[model samples]
Target: MCTETALRRENGDRFCLSTAQAETLLTGAPWRRFLVIGDEVADGRGEPAEGYGHDGWADRVAASLRRIQPGLAYLNLGRKGRLAAEIRSRQLGRVLEFKPDLTALTCCGAELVRDPFDADSVEAEFDRVVAPLRDSGGDVLLVNWFDITRFSPRSSEETERLRIRLRELAERKQAVALRHGAIYVNLAEHPAAADRDVFGADGSAPTMRGHAIAAASVIQGLGAHLTGAGDACR
Candidate 1:
């Protein structure tokens, strides 16, 4: 079981989930296998957090699940620099083979950061990647980007444009979630994501503090399903 831990926010506010609380929060969750797939975000790529170990949000989430179930199976098929299409082509097959009941997906950022991004094509690829999971009765967790534009060293106008682009991506993600009945957590829109410190110095991946925020969101989103307050998956 997890000991007392603080998932901190940038504004001096901290969210703590102790061992008992974590156990309660995740007890009865029907997750025997947890699979994470996507790009850099999915890989939890970033600098080591100040106090937290050098793991991504998915690791933290898996750790919590282990504390509760002790035997939870977790695998991360995420790689840095992989675009959405590559993720769908390379990772999706192995993912289906895993027969995971719980899964996390994120990848479009590779396209989002590049010039000449085709929103519709990326969205289509994402749909293809997630639809099978949704149909296979897997509980899907869809995480979007953080507000990393705030960390951009570009000119103010360019930075604002990047923010706008992020907002567009968030909208598409929400639509996809609604279409697939998946739980969507848009860190780009989260209050804590507004803190530039949550991003790494590279302005692409998250810092350790950012990972904490992502993990907390995943747990909180699952609480309803885990506690039987919402839909339960097989």
Candidate 2:
């Protein structure tokens, strides 16, 4: 039972999951070729702090998968600041070429931060990237953006309104995940996302410690599908 047990603590905050624990949870996994595509977060932007997971979360996830399969090939096509259309255009073609058995897609940072949000356009971009991978007959994973605004308290009515929009965005992502039978990890609802320790110095991207938690969450999301004992993707 991979509890949200703290693997270690930094500044009194509990960081969950070590690479070894993730491996234990993912034991018996059969994926070989793995592709990660999306925005910067999917790219795993963050520095490695001592005692926390290093590199990007995707790499951490791959490292664990490697322990189990020992021959996993991982490729990350995520670029920071790439808009949804650009991600769909640039990264996805390479993904098809990789033909991975397992894949992860996350494109939230750009659109969620944009003003005058377009739900339909964002949804379209999501579908464009997600649909093709689904056609490839591989397992797909999706993650929602955490409520970034929580890091900075904004009392403005517009901020509250944007929160509503964020929830709607999560729903849209879930619909896509459900439609394709992909695993969706609802980072938006995870209480730890609101914690300050998980964020980077820039106040936006995840810290490597945050990466550990995210990797654990991915394993946790797969747990139900794999062993029927982890968090529900829906």
Candidate 3:
């Protein structure tokens, strides 16, 4: 069994879950095996960028879910600096092999920073990776890119353009997720995501604290979907 620790929210409220509550909440759910695929965020890239660490959001969520389902199997296939197309090409096949009951996809963050951004191509690749998982009867978590301008070191004009492109891509992704009944975790709309303190020195990968915020956001999105509170992201 896993333990719960206190995680602070943007409003300074603490989010904590008891073991019994976790078990109750996840009862009868089919999320025993969780798989994560995408870029640095899914890979658990921490500050200093030294190596993979257990401080990323995917790690945190896995730990929390273990309390509910002690037999939970979690696998993360996130690589630093991977574009959406690369994930679709390399990781999608491995993800299918895992046959995960729940999966989270967080790609395209690296692609948004590059020039000649092609929203159509990027989204199509994302769909290619996500559509199969959705069809497999597993719950998918689609995380949206936060507003890059908040931590971007680029010129104001460049950051603004990137932000616009990312937001557009996020919207399109959300639409697809909704169509497939996947839970969408909209970090762009989360208050904590805009806080520069939540990011690392590179202004891209998240710091330890930022990972906590992200994990909390994902859990909240899952709750919304499970409780029939409407679509997780709108």
Candidate 4:
């Protein structure tokens, strides 16, 4: 059921993960005091080309939650270009120190690129990163790496293999979380929140207004998960 859809690219390559999928991953979880950990996109730091600030999906999810309860606070631990192992090596230790109610780690693409031939390294690092969270009195939420390969045009065989590898990585991460009684959030399935024209003429950073909107989206979703609230402004 988790593998229900394929994310089709402009070049006819297909990957899978949908907004429905993302929502489903969070539906039955008992979440509160959310902490989002992932790459720049998860951190809401979009590149200058994306025409939007990077708040990416976290902002959207957080905003959705706040619409119903205006007083929810979420800690975002996203960094720029943080691969799984790197995140494991750097942030995981500090995150456990905070003892959050709920913590979500979104990762993938970088690991695939960094070690295209060694998938086990990513899995092992994920286990190491998340082990402490489970040991603590916290619900670890694993946010699956979103579809970034689609962003590029190099759809070679190697690229396809990388995509498959990331998918496997997502599954492994989810398993690790589940083994520790944690929730898993998958973002590969979210629809394109940005329109083709959401970018500026130069296509680098999002206009301030655009960043606010993007941040609002992440905040909405996170709020709902954290507070059992409803939708926020679009």
Candidate 5:
């Protein structure tokens, strides 16, 4: 199911959108072009055994937006196993060329969870890509890294340490997003992130149902922004 709720900032301020406000945003001045860039999760990469049904969360968001504005242009630049820097190098230029009204950027998960994680480098690359899009007047949706430890069967010290590092990286990225006036979606705190059903065998990439949850989260985040709640980020 779609998880819709108010988002709280690190400073204790909360941002929310009422049902009527969300309805108004959906039906009023809807975005016409949607663009996505990131890794496998955003690419909707699942095991071949699972069989592909959905394209990914970005596509789901596009479908929902299309209902409000017909003939919406959609593009998905997500590639499996791509790191944040790689995404910035490959897809950033194309994103500018597309000039989308709305852009969803999901990066850094692949970098943060691996060995020799460099939080600063990842965040710098994120800003390099996102800053330009935001300057171009695109509504950027920045998705934070989720806690993959929740899906892990082991409870070792190493696992705990990795989780801590991931959280730190997420916080840094969220700060950058908010600083740039982007809509930040805190997937790490979402209840669905811990659900086994929401993930595939790899325990990282979201399943089809998981993508729906992600899509709903993005919509709710956008609704909050359109309704004036997200202005607090400024």
Candidate 6:
């Protein structure tokens, strides 16, 4: 069994949990197997200028897991520029095949570019992607899509409007996760750790640092959830 360790959050509070705590809360009472799916943010698919690389959010989460539980295994199913509809169509099969104890899904900026103003379609895509995971008895965690439109100087105003749309999508996605009892993390709302440099030097994709920090945040948050003490309660 895993052990519980005390943890302190920035806002002031105490909590504790261990890998064992994660194990305890799981449905099958088995060891942890994590599968994370996201677009560029999850995969670290930036250009040459950005400091982050193949070591995207998935890698960060894996590293954290290794530190928390040496033997834990994780699989990152991140694809660059993957819209919710795209992931729903292509990645769901592989995700179900893995049979992970926990799965985290992230996307948003890409969707804004791809789907634009299609809110209903976006919601449908989320439903399609998440339903199967829940039906399979897997513990699902949804990471609300992060938006960088506000950070762009030229498109700040347009991006801010876009951010509103993205925020609405995030809220809808969170509602779905909550309705199904899945863990939900709204990275979009995390102002303290927002990706200031959301785009790279070439102005194409998310930077490596962006991916790493975002992924790390998820890992730490999940670790806290698993340990029962809110270890990464940033």
Score candidate 6 by TM-score against the native: 0.72
Tens-place lDDT per residue, model 4, 8-115, is 221121122233433443454444466777776468654343222333556655544443335546778888778777787778766776667667677665666674
Return the top candidate by TM-score: 1
Q: Of the pair 1 and 2, which is ahead by TM-score? A: 1
Q: Per-residue lDDT for 10 in model 4?
A: 14
lDDT of 6 by residue, 143-169 (tens): 764555545554667767776787788
Off by over 4 Å in 5: 1-25, 47-55, 230-232
Q: Candidate 4 — which residues are off by over 4 angstroms? A: 1-32, 47-55, 63-73, 189-234
lDDT (10s digit) by residue, model 2, range 1-234:
123334345334444664555666787898999898888888888756665535577887787788888989999998988888898888888889989888988876778668778888888888888788878888888877566666645567756776777888888988888777788888777878878867766656777777767777787776566875554443
What order do candidates take by TM-score, descending? 1, 2, 3, 5, 6, 4
If scored against the real structure, what TM-score would every candidate get? 0.88, 0.87, 0.85, 0.61, 0.83, 0.72
Candidate 5 structure, TM-score to reference? 0.83
Clashes in candidate 2: how many?
Answer: 0
Q: Give every collision pair in model 1.
A: none
The reply for model 6, stretches above 4 Å from the true place, is 1-31, 47-54, 193-199, 202-204, 227-234
> For every candidate structure, what is the RMSD over all alpha carbons to the true structure, in angstroms?
3.3, 3.5, 3.9, 9.7, 7.0, 7.0
Q: Which TM-score value belongs to model 4? A: 0.61
> Per-residue lDDT for 177 in model 1?
81
Worst 10 residues of 4 by lDDT: 7-16
Residue range 69-176, candidate 1, lDDT tens digits: 788899999998888889889999999999998899887766766888677777788789879999999888888877777778778997887777777777777777
Local accuracy by lDDT, each model:
0.76, 0.76, 0.74, 0.54, 0.71, 0.61
Of 1 and 4, the candidate ahead on TM-score is: 1
User: Of the candidates numbered 1 and 6, which has the greater TM-score value?
Assistant: 1
* Tens-place lDDT digits, model 5, residues 119-221: 8888888889889988988888888745777776656886788788878887887888887988888878887676686776767656665665566677787
Candidate 2 regions exceeding 4 Å error are 1-15, 47-50, 153-155, 228-234
